[model samples]
Target: MSKQTDAAKEGVQQLDAAAAKVRLAELAKALGAANAAYYQDDAPDLSDAEYDALKRENAALEARFPDLKRPDSPTEQVGAAPSAGFSKITHSQRMLSLSNAFDASDVQDFVGGIRRYLGLGDNAPLPFTAEPKIDGLSLSLRYENGTLVHAATRGDGTTGENVTSNARTISDIPTTLSGAPEILEVRGEVYMSHADFAALNARQEDAGDKTFANPRNAAAGSLRQLDPAITKSRPLRFFAYAWGEVSVPLAETQTDALARLEALGFQINDRTKTCDSGEEMLAHYARIEEERADLGYDIDGVVYKVDDLSYQRRLGMRSTTPRWAIAHKFPAELAWTSLEGIDIQVGRTGALSPVARLKPVTVGGVVVSNATLHNEDYIAGRDANGAPIRNGKDIRIGDTVQIYRAGDVIPKVADVDLSKRPATAEPYAFPTACPQCESQAIREEGDAVRRCTGGLICPAQAVEKLKHFVSRAAFDIEGLGAKQVEAFHTDGWIKEPADIFTLRERFGQGLQQLKNREGWGEKSAENLFQAIEEKREIALARLIFALGIRHVGEVAAADLARHYTSWDALAETVDKAAPAATAHRAAEEAIVAERAKAADEGRRANLSAARDAAWADTQPEAKAAWDDLIGIDGIGATVAVSLVTTFQQATERASIDRLVAMLTPTAPETRATDSPVAGMTVVFTGSLEKMTRAEAKARAESLGAKVSGSVSAKTDLLVAGPGAGSKATKAAELGIETIDEDGWLALVGDG
Candidate 1:
């Protein structure tokens, strides 16, 4: 062959090789993104078929060219990297992920492995804590001096982002703990309830704002917001499951710690149980899976952790997961339904979101007719050819859409069939104005949302706000709920939350008559009134959050409460503070001046500092007027702004005044340090020398010294008796102080 011809052929071969590599890289990227979305975000960007196709292609490519596999390849990782917006915080004790088992055979294999690792006989019992694998963001909250000081998101298991400010927004997360240790770091998941998610989406639709794909995605997105104000707007809740760093030991068993978390006002998952054997654990998982659809929140699987800490220690860990724990995941529930039509929904925030009207199909025992379309881009598939797809392509009016009902009760459109689209079907045009309020709708720069200008006047927004005020995580008024709130509002029994407190007096005589009329009774009415009375002395944080103020959440309320000390003080300051227009004008002028003086040495920095200092000074004075009045902890400027804005109207102020008159603020709990074991760190090892594990834990807790299972340096005394194993040796090696059964008895004065 000629030399020129050979060179040309070689060049063509190289070009083909490069193109193949590019295709492989694209496949890998797509697979990784899909996995991250499904696992971390709880919002799958692709259907199972599409994802499986990509995975197969990627696997084939990797096999064809093993050298091309990158170090950060999707196949090598268990989960996605930690989010970047949060601050990195290294855990005192590594928070390990769990190994997953998909089927009964897998569960049997896992149990077999555990048996082999522990060297147990064929019928040896293996105790475990079977808990729901909450499909939400994992976080760690630290409390100091009986007060929450920091909250962090689980990043890479070892380190996390500091989201204390945002975490405070969850009402269930206490600002100041009761019966808490000097230093307590508890880990848990933050989630949104199905009811709240529905209301929030409805409000979003009413206001023409984009709706979240699912409750889990809504929760993750909310918790990850850099601005606490934004996070506060979301209906988020927390349920603690583990502990990290602690000054005092928590409890002898994992179950005890869960109870302690609950006593300290931290929410604990109610479904957790201590199983005596792997069989019991499996049974519990089966029971939970059967009732998973009825649960108020999303849960993907069940987590089984070794109940005996000593057994867990012996098993140790491997890489990112502890051998002591395993996740038992149920099969994903997917169904195929015809996409009959597309609908536009306006939200409370005024963003317009698309909804897929589907043929009613039973999924996990519930009939689902509609699924969230997410956004315009999502509906159009954001593709070049505009092929029918749910996640990556548009769904026509008559296309078949694959729907999946994961942990979330709501089904989401997973994929669309282009071939099934009717030829007469036309592209869906999203609405340009609010359907309810007929307000001008606009999409802002860099945002994927189209929002309406309408505010509180919209019926949907009003109902949603009312529901938020009485929500379980907010005011927690026992008898009032979405249905009741809607009924009262429609009947004029309550126009606002404050009006609720006055219903008894305004209609007391008529109440009895109304009770006798229909769907009411003397007992029910009395129960409701009692429930209302019970909430009269709620903490300032709850009260502030219950006001239904925009952008004011639990954390912000706590910050404002701490800063101002009193509601009256905050109200007056907000009333007198400069308006948003004034603040904007001042900022504009300051920016112009700074730009003009940019040439001056260090002038920009100095000017910026001065402006910041001035703003801070003004904020404290105003914030103090309100937060200091309430004596609540953790209330900040953002919360103050929300409170002020909510109470700005004369009607709102009057309602607040009435609420204040009917309510009496309770005194904050005082921190206690009077327990006999207050300063001691006690570890319970071996089959308890004297009492049952539960009895020993309770006794240790009563004495004030925290009781832990594993021995660590911080542990002051190791209470060893019978069956003491590796912990005793580790304690001895660390030179940690040890105490025997008799010594423990003498310390507690029971000798």
Candidate 2:
């Protein structure tokens, strides 16, 4: 949100009472509609950026013309009105929202304001506690005499929905407490993890149910379910950050009080640290932002609270937010850049993903020049569900677009600014032909991706597939790099992956002469040949990953290799079982679509019966292989379809046959039984003083431990380093053993 943009709406020139009055009227209408969409419909039409802009414009207008301010001004409001679907619960104390600071200057102003409010000198020590602000639904849980009682959502600050039964389903909330006050109100956030959200969406798709757009929405929708059983089925976590009402004070400081809450069996984010200065607080925020992607959950900002309870009481509450605390949010991580060009890059699966090449601009410390356009629909201003994105504004070649990244390594186009759109810009017409081979590109029904139908014939997909086959995580030949692969491909020296192995015999004695080539000498060419020969035998998992199957990532490839152990067994099973698996998948999809469209109960019942019949028609001969494939954890229908369908393709099959003939795939490495951490699940958080995470994970695997990316009940040990946050706290709550780097080394005999 920029001053220049809002200037036209409620610009500085509109300081007059008459102009302010008109601007106030516009703000009221816009805010009302946004509130209705957010609270009542649970579908927001405006982004947070837009909503914040509306509020700021209203505030600026009211500030200039206080006498002319309307009675329905947004300045006096808190949360939106409570949803009528649920019974409301009145709060004993107001559950006010926090004021937000989007930049360093806003944060400095906040510190200065608190100092001035308390009449403290510039040199006075004003300690503050900084905690990661979880982006989820705010909840208040009330307890009486150490017994769990009721819970409510933050509906309208004063009144909230009574969701006691639904809140009981959250494992983080204790049913009882000890050594506590007669009555206590614990305020926190309820959230869903990224992994859980993905799993829930998968389950929803399988059951033909509606899926949510993000984790926050999923958590809200799941917790607000009418049936408690439904809420119980969703994996929701909680963190106790603040309190609403208490019979007695828990501690003198915010940091100490959080410890008290943890002692009472409530979850606390361990990243909460006390800072003596505002600069340190900002630095802590930067650290959190750096580790944001690995947090396992979503957080939009870091909150700074006056650590001293006595000082907090002095600077009390404003109309809608507390004077003692403020949320310092990360910058939108968005930047406006010219759309230099739109290039179609075909993936190994032949999906044509439109990538926007932008004029280089820095966003959140990274210079980003490319952003994902998602699909053709996205370029035309539509989302996966055909809903208007960027307010129905389409992107053009010369248009300036706003791109943003939320912990994702790859940035995405958030919106297109039509105001700066060039007059010469024409509507981007997405090509229906493959950019590489000129093959027809088609979009499958129920999927948003448009794919090239050229299979192995398309040069883009072919080159990518070959590159993936020999990359670091795949075959990993010593002398083979992307540049070498392209050179070999363009010269017709290698059309398939197997050609690399036969290069010496075919070209070593040719008239072209190995020593006479550009950028290649006799020694280098011989070294390349020897390197390829040395890799004649490779790991089975690496080979599986090298096939470039859709949905078969490195982990999935490893899981499959661990299950099947041998190439012949896995290949033969998938080849023979693909037909039955493919048929069952087709039937399942049809049944789900039909059930979704069925208007009457009788029609839905008929569709259910058809689904049952479809299951019954599956061939028992191929059932075991299909069942085994799906039985592997995380290897669901989506993965099964990809793995099997690739093998089922005649062209793909021929390509794989060529690669397989040139290499002998070996089994996974045997673990050391004598190691103490054998058969254990370990996770490493924060930076290690002596080694990298990759080294730690590799060592753990060599010692027979399974290194997982997240902390769960199954996690046997957590190696916490400095700045360990949510994972450390969750591990402590779950009673997982924690150790330092030295302890880890000792366990592995290195110490």
The candidate scoring highest on lDDT is: 2
- Tens digits of per-residue lDDT, candidate 2, 1-751, equal 3332332222222233332343344455457656656665677665444454455445444444545443334544455667778889999999987766655655788898888767678999999999999978899999999987889988767888888999999999998999878989999999999999999999999999988777877888788888999999999999999998999998999999999999999999989999988899899998998999999998877999999999887667755678889877554345789999999877666778778899998765557777666677778876656677667788899998876643222356766788898889999899899998999999877666778999878887777778777765578686676667877788888888888888888974542565577888877777788888888899998888877686676667886786567899898778767866867777787687677667554453356666666667667757666765765544677778887888877877888898799888998775886889887778899868766565576688778776766676667999998889998998999999999999999889888
- Candidate 1 residues 588-643, lDDT tens each? 55666676677575444456654553354455444334433222223334444555
- The lDDT of model 1 is 0.64
Looking at candidate 1, the ten consecutive residues that score lowest on lDDT are 7-16
| Runs with alpha carbons beyond 4 Å of true place in candidate 1 | 1-300, 304-328, 343-354, 364-366, 375-377, 380-392, 441-452, 555-565, 572-644, 647-658, 673-751
**What clash count does candidate 2 reach?**
0
In candidate 2, list every pair of residues with a backbone clash.
none
Give the alpha-carbon lDDT of every model.
0.64, 0.76
Could you tell me the lDDT of residue 531 within candidate 2? Answer: 86
